[model samples]
Target: MKKLSFSLLAMLGFFAIVFVSCKDDDNGDPAPLTPTIASITPSSGPVGTSVTIAGTNFGDSPSVSFGTTSATVASGSTATSITTTVPAGLSAGDVNVTVTAGGETSAASTFEVTEGTAPDVTTVVDTVVALEDLSSLETAVVAAGLDDDLAGDGPFTIFAPNNEAFDSLIANLDVADLTAVVAALGGANALAGVLQAHVVADSLPADLIAAQDYPTLNAASTITITVEGDNVFANGAQVIGEQIIADNGVIHVIDSVINVEAPAVDPGEPNVVRVVASPDGLGAAETNWTADNTYILDGFIFVNDGQTLNIEAGTIIKGRPGQAARASALIVAAGGTINATGTAADPIIFTGEADDLNGSVPDDANALWGGVIILGNAPTNNNDVGGVKSVEGVPTEEGRGQYGGTDATENSGTFTYVSIRHGGSLIGANNEINGLTLGGVGSGTTINNVEIWSNLDDGIELFGGTVNVSNLVVSYSGDDGIDIDEGYTGNIQKAVVWHTGSTIISTDPRGMELDGGDGPNETAMPFTTPNLANITLFYDDVDGSNLTDAFVMRDNYGGSLYNSIAFNHDAPIDLERLTTLGESSYDRYTAGDIVISGNILFNINGVTDAANFADLFEISNEGDAALETEVETALAAANMVVDPGFGTGATKFTPTADAVTDLDSDDDGTDDELPEGVQNLGYKGAVDPAATEPYFANWTKTWAVISQ
Candidate 1:
């Protein structure tokens, strides 16, 4: 009887549990559909307006209705978002919107559907339509078969050649039937490419080209822009018409046609000496040039006042490194044009050793030497000078300059692209010269785009000259990269110097070096101070590192450096007077005159103070906020380049035996030069751990230090 009663109780408990469970399963209350309405760009979206909805919880396939009218749902993956093109017959009124997701719909939301406006076409963008104005461009394009390519979906940049440009291209062509230009292009396929040649992908407004470089789509080709006295030209073709509206692209009418260089067959080799001097006379020496950032010639170079001796781009002139004529490669008389332009890739190079061969070892190939010089209206601090004078406001020895004519306007020569590498050879080690030694370089001299890389001595040691240069790169010099003792008032911008040794290791500040106390006398440069703007440097101090406080602005060193940066140095910044000046008015020049602001100085050598650090800025401004601000700004712009792109750590030495000598050192030395049983070939500077360690440093001098 008791068991029966327990069973009845259990059955009743089970029924109660089932009822409770059923009630729990019945979640009739739907999840609170949180509604969020993000704004659509245009409240009154046009009938065909492709609008984006910005909101939350718009579940996929949510039905968005325009009032009572059912609109075709476009995209609905969120409860708070839905996109539907405006249906026809919509008026200005608040339309109800609801989002439905997972068999559930959200509460009605409000959206404004206003009367739509007509679609308007703003400015049209064009693709690849060459200006119809170019006289001979059409002919060349048809010949090249670029017409169709221009008509295609592309914005090409074509270095269109004018009538004269066409003449220049076809002058040597043996094909007689010039009328078949289009036919010879292999049909419309070629036409498209031909026309495409006249178009740059980006529509370059004619005004943006100001002695600048622009990239083009053509393979290994770029549009050469020349702005001569406001006359703009592409590929030497005048822009007759511009901004022609078209569906494809803009059309700027030009006067000429551009031509691509054809491959030339080489003539048999003859005398290498004649080839150096009379390069163009023999054949196109443009191929396989021997030098860098410089040109060589066996021909007579003529220069007249106002006239220039402009060595065109990529011209190389070899200086006999082993042979007898290794001393001087090019000698520019006082006047004439010297427009030696060299690009970083193909700098006009002038070297002594063979192009691909290694530099002469020791007393032999020391930068088989040659250099470039331009005489202008400037002063000189030749060896015979009495005392070092400030180069400020001092019209340097303009002797033999202004060769073109009396008018400075006519005086023209440019050295936009040039690199004189391995030029400064040792007449003797102590009395070695510089790479680009300006004797009387004047203001008229076009001295930009000049570089001196891997010189045995200082990169650019100016004797006396007034030359303005921007974008000059000086790297890996045995001596200082630039040593301007004598007067040189030239503006330098975007100059990058990567020195492994002393960037400016002056022997004597009394030499009138601006780095120490370059002033008129005691007054510095009377009233004028030379300027150095946008100067940046990264130095790698190898053996026998000369201490440089970035720049040691001394007594008469007056200049303006804007937005400059210094990195990886023993001492990053210094502004102080190195020598005591005379009682003359030249003494008036103080370190305060230098307007240094918007600069950055970052010391990556891990030195905090001058005492702890081998060197840092030693001068102070007595809490001057202006000076401090300049100093701080300079610091911010500067940083260290940890990886010099060279392999890290020790470099390999030259020995083929089973030796366990280390191929590295703290000072970047190789194992080959280690003192084994072999005679002391001495320390060879391996600046880069990757490439065969170059003999960059005066290895003998460093070896002496190591030996001690």
Candidate 2:
């Protein structure tokens, strides 16, 4: 019994020893020793400098920190030695070095940060490759085969998005990874354009940046930079992190990806609420046209004398198709008034019934309906019986169409921020309606920020009116952008006349057709002495289909042009010496009554050579050497035949900084200085280069959807 008890005790002791050994194996060695830093090689250095941390018990994947900022662990590190580069955003000062491993952190060590010289960077491509967060950008650069171009010696500014940006973009697109995002972005060619949109061809440092649109490598795109307080945004994406400096360029980290598609603009729905506008007599009570409904004109609608038509902003007025006296139009008779004031956010639109405002109609669609006509009791050179004349485009017997009286300051109404599209119809032979016809309109009538596009006839025709206009944009007009006749003596400032190289009507298209008066009374009084300043006339005849001149000054036109620009036209100026009574504009030019100076003309007839200046004026009397010399001398003194440095594609009409500076500093005043009461806030064109928001932008259909 004693032997058995001794054996049981031995067995129990053996089992206990086995259990202890198994437990020790499961615990697995001792917890790793706390990491330690013996010394740091070259303890002081700048950011991005290679740093070696020599210490004890540093595990394979130990993390490192300089003060509170984290440093990226470089490759080829050992258990006892760790390599890292000094992190960015660190100030020049002393920072504590720390090593953390196996859930243990080492005591802090001192590291002195000193400002160092900029790194000797290679190409932007190389710089991108060196950044871990920019791996996605590097991948795209390689995939797009733009690596070679970017690697070359270049002054490139790259707006790079980090991996997290790409991740966010991928998630937004409902895609899995970068590859999927690329595929979803319309494959390689489209992705290439999108990627190029982030890069500018020129080097732009942070200090040189401003609140403006920066042209990108993608010709059609511009990175619009908006600075709010201390934050800078590119295409609504916040620029994050420090700007990475490179040899040939800079790299700005953006938080979000730029959209690959064109900026989506909601043009509002078409045909909301339908209502028929009365053809005549709006009564003494004010007729309010609201935006929540669409007003339709079945025939020539008339706002009779002493009546008022108030159109709300964003109101849509559609005219039905007809001809002759039955044409659909809105005629504000003499002594009538229309208060059509619209904001930039909500412009009053006038179109034909067929127009859906969805860009479905062809750009050249015109003559679909008659246009808006305002007749006032203001003086005209062609006044007949009782010092009045029947307005054209209206029936001769229509007593309400008679315009002209002794009053030069008659108040017709206010028309601001209004867009007239798809109008101008042939109501009579050689008498097509204009987009906005001001027949004997007085100086008291306020017309500003008006856009007339796709009109069959002139965009805005002023017939013996003293009504001054500002901020006018006339695009794709079938006839002249602005046609002045019957001795119009008013001021037109800051106007943009763009002809897209296509003619919707057979009539000659010109930037401005200035005529003193109609035939038989061509040289009648007032002399069409309109003062125009800061006008930009552009003809985009990429297909070489247009051959019209920019300005056709004829019929004894005696006007002054100052601080204007004309580009891509066959000829800048044309003077008619019609060998007929009172039809010689050259006579007016020689008399110093017609001044065309301080203007910029570029690429006339597709050539930048100043020799083209010889062809600048197309006059009927080519043999008149004295007249030619006088005109040449006047133009050569103040005009430039060099490139105006316009932006490309969507911003094709926008001027560059140098162009604006050159024009703004122009002191050419005396002869062609703007008359008093006209603001000479000159930038030499319709759109001000230094303006944060363009006058012709956002609201105009051409700027919002058509041009894009």
For each candidate, what is the lDDT?
A: 0.41, 0.69
Model 2 TM-score, 2 decimals: 0.59
> Mind giving the per-residue lDDT tens digits that candidate 2 earns over 248-297?
11122222222232222223446444334454566555789999888877
Candidate 1 structure quality by residue, lDDT tens digits, 547-608: 45455444444545544455556543544433344421122223344555433344534553
Error of 2 at 349 (Å): 0.6
**Residue 446 displacement (Å), model 1:** 1.9
For candidate 1, the lDDT comes to 0.41
The residue-level lDDT of candidate 1 at 572 comes to 36
Scored by Cα lDDT, where does model 2 land? 0.69
Per-prediction tally of clashes: 115, 0
Q: How many clashes would you count in candidate 2?
A: 0
Model 1 ranges off by over 4 Å? 1-268, 271-308, 322-326, 343-346, 357-366, 379-412, 501-528, 542-547, 572-592, 604-615, 619-708
